[model samples]
Target: MSAVHEVAPVVDAAHAEPYATRDEYAGAIGRIRSAAEAYYAGADLVMDDAAYDALLARVAATESAQPGWAASDSPTTTVAAGIAGGDVEHSTPMLSLDNVFDGDELASWAARLERVLGRPANGYTVEPKIDGMAVAARYVDGRLSQVATRGDGRAGEDVTVNARLVAGLPAELARPVTVEVRGEVFMTDADFERANELRTGHGGTAFANPRSAAAGTLRAQDRAYDAPLSFFAYAVHDLPGGEGLFHSAAMAAIADLGVATTAGPMAAITEPGVTATTTPTAATTDPEATTTSSPPAGMPLCATIDDVLAAIESLGAARGSLGFDIDGAVVKADDPADRDRAGFSSRAPRWAVAYKFPADTRTSRLVGIEVQVGRTGVITPVAVLEPVQVGGVVVTSATLHNFDDLVRRDVRVGDAVFVRRAGDVIPEITGALLDARPDGATAFMPPQVCPRCGGEIDRSQKRWRCVRGRACGAEESLAYFAARDSMDIEGLGDKVIAGLVRAGLVTDPADLYDLDAESLAQLERLGRTSAAKLVATIQGSKTQPLSRVLTGLGVRMTGRSMSRRLARHFGTMPALQAATVDDLQRVDGVGPERAATIAAELAELAPVIAKLTARGLTMSEPELPTRPAAPGSAEALEAPRLPLQREDGSPMTVVVTGSVPGLSRTEGNEAVERLGGKSSGSVSKRTDLVVVGDGAGSKATKAEELGIPCMPAEEFATLLAQLTAVRLG
Candidate 1:
C-alpha cells in the first residue's frame, strides 16, 4: 500500500483471461493448494507470489461467477492442509490471509467488504506483514505452558523448549491470565549473518534465507546451538471466555505483557467509496495521520484512504531500515465486533486483506553464460549480467543452479532477463524476457569437458562431475591430501597449496612426490632453507601408513575411521584395488550402495595408486606377527615369530584405553597396526585383547564385562620389547 496515485493495472498476459471451464478452475485451485502446503512447510515455493496470485484471482472470479461449481476443499475456501509430523493439536485453526497486489485489487476487496457489511466499512488497521514462521504460545495463569508452530493451521509440533530460547519471548505474563498469543518467529539480518557464519565455521550448509533459518532453528530438537531468533505477538485469544479483542487493543495488551509486537502503529483506513484517483495533502488529511520518523507510541488514526495510502508509503520507504523483513502490509478491521460481523471464510477473514508489494526485480541484459567448477567437480552455470541494482545490492552475476535449471528457465546469452535477489546470497534470473530476446539466440549446451581441467564429464548424474575426480578440483583436493589426518605433510598450508596450483606445479597428489628443494624454492615466499624442509616433509609423507594414504584420496563416503577399517581389512593397496563390490560389502561399515561406489572409485584410482607407488610411496602393509613353527618346521626358518598374536595365530583386535605411560592414543594405534593387529577405539565381544593404561575408563570396564583378556601398560610394553627382540634375532 502506497500513496493513492492513479496507475494502470500491470496484467499478466497469460492469466488475464477468465477461466472458461470448471476443469480449469479446479486445476488452478489444486495447484495453488499444493504450492501453499509446500510454502507453509518451509520448502521452496513451487510458484512465485505473482503467478500464484494470478491463479488465485482466476479461481476467485470463477467461484464468484458459479458458486455451486466451487470445490468444497478449494484453496479459496480452506486453509492450507497442515503438513504431517505435528504432535500437538491446536485449540483453533490458524488461517491464511487473502493478498492483493495493487491499488485496483485493494479497492475491489474493500468494495466487496462494504457490500457484505451493508455499509461503507470503516475503522481499518494496517501493520507490516512479517515474512516468518507463525507460532502460537499458550500461557496458563501467568506462566508459559506450551508453544506450537502453525502446522496445517489446525495442529503443530510442541516446541516449548526451543520457543523459550527465542529472544524477546516472555516465559511469564505481567498478570495472571489464561490465553494463547499468536505471533511470528523471525531472524533479523544480523542474526542471519551470524548464524550463517557459525554454520560455515562448523562446515555445515548455510541457510538460504532468514525465514528458512528461523523455521529450521525453531523446529530443531536440540536446543544446544545459540541460534538467534526473535518473536512478535500479533494477536491474542483469551481461553474459556473465547472473546476476541479489537486488533489495536490486543496488540497493546500483548506488548504490555512483555512480548514485542510488530513495529509501527495501526494506521486506520476509513475513507468511504475512495477510488485510486483520490488524493489528499497534509492539510486535507486528518492531523492524527501525520507521519513520524519512528513508529508512533500507539495506533494512529487515518480518516481517509489518502491518509492510509500515505502511511503505507511511509512504511514502504522505511522497510530497508527495519530490523525484520516484511513482505507486505496487512489491513485489518479495527473493531472486533466489525470483524465478527463480517464473518469468516473457510480459510481467511473476510474483514482483512494483505497488500503485497511488487517483487524486487530488475531487468538486465545477459552478457554471457560462464560455467564454474565446484570443489566436488559439479559444473554450475553462472549468468554474466550487465550490472543491475536489485534490492539495494548491485548484482553483476546470477547463478543458474545447474544445466537443467538453465534449460528450464530457457535463459540465453543475449536475451534480456529479470533478476531477483530475495534472501539468497547470490542473485538469480527469474525468467528470460522472451519478448526482448535478440535474434540468433540459442539454447546453451553443457560442455563435454570440465571448463577448468579439460577432463571428461560424467552426465549420468543430475549434477555433472569430472571423470578425473578430485584432480579436476585441484587446489581443494591437494589441501585435503596434505591435511594432518591424511599425508600429515607439515608446512603445506592453504596459501602454499594455492600458489602451487596457480603456478601449475601440481595437479594430482602424486605430483607432490616429484617436488625437490629447487622446484619448491621457485614458489613465492619459500626460501631455500624452507624449500628443503618442505621437500623433506613431502619425502617423509611417502611412508605414512596405508590408512593415511586412503584417507587422503578423498573417496566419497570414506573418512578417517572408514579408511583405517579398509586398510586393516585389505592389508595392501593391491588387495584393496582388486576388491569386488561383494568383497567390499563384507567390511564393517560398507553397505551395498557404498560398496559399489568404493569399488568403482578404487578402479578409477588404480593408475593413480600405481604412480604413487612408483614414486617410492609405501604400497603394502608391514610384516605382522608370524606363527611359531612346530619342531624344526620350515616356517620357523622363514620368519621370526612375535608374541602379539591370538591363540589361533591371527592378529588380535586390540582396544587401547586411557593414557599409556609414554605413548599417545594415535601412537598406540600405529604400533598395533605395525604389529599386524587391528586397533579398535571401543571394546566389544569381538576384541581379542584390551590394553589398559593409567586412568582407564569405561572401555576397560566393558572389556572385563565381555571377558576379553586385559594387558597392563607395563605388560604391553614388555610384549612390544619381546616382538622387537624376535624381529632382530
Candidate 2:
C-alpha cells in the first residue's frame, strides 16, 4: 500500500498548534462542519475522512480540557446536524438506523434487542438496503404534505419542493388517510448510469456512487426531483393514538397505498422496541416513556425483533436475484407494545440496526499519465497508473481528469497514487500521500501543442483545445471528412485512420490522393482486396457536395447546424471566401464577429486551396450556396479586417502569464472578456499587453523578446479599472 511508503508530509497540518481559546475551538468546529455540508452537497470533498475525524477529536479534547471555553457549537456537547437547506418538514423526524459490520456484530446486536424487549422477534422483514438518502414523506388527508431528510437525528433539511419532484412521492395518497411513509430516495442503476453519461457529455466530472449521486442531485440549488431519481418505501408512520400499528403492518399499509416496498414479515415475532405516533413530539416522547425494571436473566429471545430479523435475513439472501442494489439488511423489533417499553436514544431506536457486508480493498502504484482530447475539444489528462490489486481485482491506470486538476493536486511523475475498486468496477484514485513521493518526481505540464495535430493550443471560457480547431490537419480531419454532414465517406473510422497513418502513406489530406495498391499490400492486416477498396474510397472524396466540403474543412464553430446556415448564407465557396465581415453580418443568422471569423478563416485557407490546385487536386466549384445580389454592389468582394474588441467596447488583446490570485489561468481569459477585451493565448510583437503574475517565466520572457507591453496582475487590474473609467466617462 502507498500508505506504507515513507516520505515528506502532504498538506500536513498534523503538527500545527491547537486552538488557544475555547471560542476559537468551537468556531472552528462550526466552520469545518459548514464546509463539509456544502462540499458534500455538490463540490469535491475538501478534507479527507481522517482529517475530519481528527478535527472532531481536537474539538472534543479542547472542550473537555477547558470548561470555560466550552461553547454551544462545541463538538463535545453538540452533534453535527444534517443539512438545513432543505425545506422539507417531515411528518416525523427521519431517524437513523444503527449500523453493524459483521455477522457476529449483527447477532450480538440482535441479542441486545432481545434483552431489552424481553423476548425473541417473531419474524423479520429483510430487504436490500438502498444506498441513498433516507427520507420521510407525509400525506395529510389525501394529499402530499411534507418531506424531509434524515438530518443529524432530530432536524433535517426541508426538501419538500425538491422531494415532490421525486417519482414515488405521490401528490395524492391512495388510501386517503393521513399517512407518513419513510423510504430511501435513490437513483436507479440505469438512472445512475445515464446521469454519469450526461455529465460526461457536458464535459463535467462523473459522480462516485449512487448514494452520493442521489444526495448531490437533491442538494443542488434551483434543481428539483423532476429528474428521474427513484424512491422505495421501507417503513411508515401513521395513527392518531400512535400505539396500534405493528412494524410489519405499517410497512404493508405503505405498500397497499401505492408505495413500492419489499414483502415484509413473510415469517416472524418478537415485540418491537418502538411504535408510530403522528404527534410532533411522539417520536422523542413515547420512546423514553417505557423502561425495563431489571436486566434479563439469560440469553433473552426477542419477542418483536427476532421474527422481523429472520425475515429480513431471508430477503437479503434473495436481493441479488430480484434485480436491485443493497448494501445491508435491516433488523427492527416487531411488537409495538415492547418497542414503547425499550425507549429511545439520541439518534436511533434501541431495536433496529443494519447488518453490513464486507467490502474488499487493495492498493496499487501510479506509473504514468496520458492526455485524451474529448469530442467537445476538452483535453483530459488520464493517468497511466501502475497496475495493482484492489477489491480482489487487478487494476492499472486511473484518471487525473484535466490539466487544472494536475496543477491543483501537485501529483508528480513518480509519486504513488492510491487506487481503490468496489462492487466489481474499474479502480479509481482515493488518496495521494505526498509522504510517499519518490525521488526525481517531475510535475506534469500540459502540452502547448495539440497531442494529435501538433497545432498551437488555446483556451476559452469552456476548455482548452487545439487552436487549429477543425482546421488542424490530423485524424480528426479524417473523421470530419467521413462524417454524414461532410464528404459522407462511409466506413472510414479510427482504425482506418490508424492503418493509413502507420503505413507512412497518409500524413496530410493530400496524401490520401497518392495511395497505391503496392503500399496497401505491405500492411499487417490488409489484404489486396481491402487495399483496393480503401484506395477506391479515397478517390471518391472528390465528388462530395459543397456543404460537405465546407464542413469537412473542419471550420471552428461551424458544425452541421452552422455549416447549413453558412452554406445558405454565401451559397458558394468563392462568395464565402470573398465576402467581408460586414457582408457576413448582413446575412440573416451570422453576427458581426461570427462573420469576421468566417472571413478570416476563408482568407487563411486560400493558400491551402491554392496548394491543392497546384497539385492537380479536383476543384469542383458548385453553384450551390450562391449569394443573393445586392443593388449597385458586388457580392464576391473581399471582407475588410478590423481589430477585436473587449466587452466594454475597447480594442485590446491581453495576454496573461503565470498565476493570478483572483483567477485561474483559464479564468483570467474570462476576466478579460468581462472587461470588454479579447484574451490572446500567445505573446507576439503584435500583442497589445501581457498580464504577468507569479511564476512568470517562459511566457513573460517571450513577451519581452517580442517587445510586447507587459504588466503585473495587480498593475493590469489597475489598468483595466482606468480603461473602464475612460470608457464610462
Best by TM-score: 1
Off by over 4 Å in 2: 1-42, 46-91, 197-205, 223-226, 239-243, 264-325, 359-729
TM-score of each: 0.46, 0.42
Candidate 1 lDDT over residue span 1-729, tens digit each: 010001123345234556888888877777776666655655433444445655667777788788888777666665553233377888877888887766677778877888888876667777777778889999899678999987767778888888876655677767687889898877765566566566555555455456666777888765346677777666788744446666777776666666666632422211211111111111101110112122221234454444455456445554543545567778877777778789887778898888776544456789999998755466778899988665557789987766755665577899767665543235766566555578999989889788888888888865678887676788888888898878889999999998888888888889989888898898999999999999999999988878889888877657676777677778789899988889998776566767887887777777778889999888664543344424245654455434555444455778888777667676677667556566776554557888899989987886775568998987877767666676678
Candidate 2 TM-score to native: 0.42
Per-residue lDDT over 1-729 for candidate 2, one digit per residue giving the tens place of the 0 to 100 score: 001121212221223345777667867677566645643353433343223434544665666667677665443333333343344444455555555644566678767766876776544444556656777777788677877776654556767776666655566666577877787777654565556656545555555445556777765566322334666677777644345677767665665565555452211111111121110000001110111111111111233443344444433433322223455666666667757776766546776676653322223456777887643244657777656544335567765645654565566677655444434333445335465567888888788878876776776632466776544445666676667556656556777777777666675556666777678768767788877887787678766545556666665545543554465556666677777788877754455545675676677667655654454544443332123234223432332212224223333767888887666664566456445344665554346888899989877876775567787788766655565465568
In candidate 1, how many Å is residue 382 off? 10
> Which consecutive 10 residues in model 2 have the weakest lDDT in total?
279-288
Assess each prediction's global lDDT (C-alpha) against the native. Answer: 0.68, 0.55
Q: TM-score of model 1 relative to the true fold?
A: 0.46
